[model samples]
Target: MSKKNSESDSANGVRLDKWLWAARFYKTRGLAKDAIEGGKVDYNGAKGKPSRMVELGALIGLRQGYDDKVVEVLGLNDQRRPATEAQALYQETPESIAARERKAADRKANNGALVSEHRPSKKERRQIHRFKSDVFSGESL
Candidate 1:
């Protein structure tokens, strides 16, 4: 291990999920584990097991929905840090940065998601209310 790495791992190797969470890669350990299990995370550009040990210099790939990001492991942290400090634990290479940007652009171009900006039309709203009323009515045929 590099001298810098030795200093960080002094606390014992952090769990993969915990590392991701502490590094601000994922919001929670559950999400981190899910990413690992889903094959969305790769170590050294190869598939990695969720239990894989991480040290400095290891390349990590992450896929969260429409985004695919990669960062080089810099330090280990057992506890979650503030958002500002959390991002300090790793370094992202230019290649990964470009890839992620392209992936995001592609996702935006191909996926017609109106998730946040959409509102149901009046007819669509009426259909939902009618369905609920029919399901709850006392009389049955």
Candidate 2:
């Protein structure tokens, strides 16, 4: 127990990728590294690197799916833990939470506009193809 504590406590700050994975932000360190390299992550308002050390209380901005999240590091853990425990490692800022909620609401409101009644039947598919061909044919123009 003491040895484990010593090892876990030894890290003053974990690598950006490692911390992201450990905190459940990304499923794997490689994915986290990719995100950092792809300009999807920012540390303390600057671009982040995979090898960068993640210090506590530092703000991290990362894009996850459709939501751009900003979290403040509260603790550092090198090893990945369960989702609940991982959540404890950082706190999403109130502004980030509000933004995410607003985006979600907007998406929900617009979702109905994108829904179709049903998939086109085979006959309808053929008709669509014919219509497209006729529209593009020079003879019609």
Candidate 3:
């Protein structure tokens, strides 16, 4: 028979990055580390390193490429889980749900993308060249 223990009594608490990876939220530990370092992950409204420990009931925020996920820490483990099973580790808040919806609306109205200061991609450079070629050529307007 398996015995159940309280959350605090069990050795379930772990580093934030570990929990994220185990929960299948991120593919690798490095990805989790980068996210934490870039301030894309927060615990209890405070930015912290990837090695930060997470306790039960702590509020966690995850900002991925185009979405922000908020969850309450329910449990922690050292093993990764399937996409579906991993999702059950945390409970999503209503506020985060609303925030994500609003962000989606804003993004659609603003060119269907979130404008970033990052450098242009190679495709963008090619488009720029093509546009300039046609506009700067000796063609009639």
lDDT of 1 by residue, 1-141 (tens): 566875566366766787898887788889889889889998888887777777778888888777777788887776787988878889998998898888778788767674546677899899989988898784664
Candidate 1 residues lying further than 4 Å off, grouped into runs, are: 1-11, 109-141
Per model, state how many residue pairs clash.
0, 0, 0
Question: lDDT winner among the candidates?
Answer: 2
| TM-score for each candidate, following the candidate numbering | 0.65, 0.76, 0.68
Show model 3 residue runs off by greater than 4 Å: 1-12, 112-141
lDDT of 2 by residue, 1-141 (tens): 376774665366788998999999899999999999999999999999998988889999999989999999998888888999999999999999999999999999899887879999999899989998988895767
Off by over 4 Å in 2: 1-10, 116-141
In candidate 1, how many clashes are counted?
Answer: 0
Global Cα RMSD, each model:
7.1, 5.7, 9.4
Give me the candidate number with maximum TM-score. 2
Model 3 error, position 101 (Å): 0.7
Q: Write the per-residue lDDT of candidate 3 for residues 45-87, one digit (tens) a residue.
A: 9996787787889999988879898989877765676767777
Which candidate do you rate higher for lDDT, 1 or 3?
Answer: 3
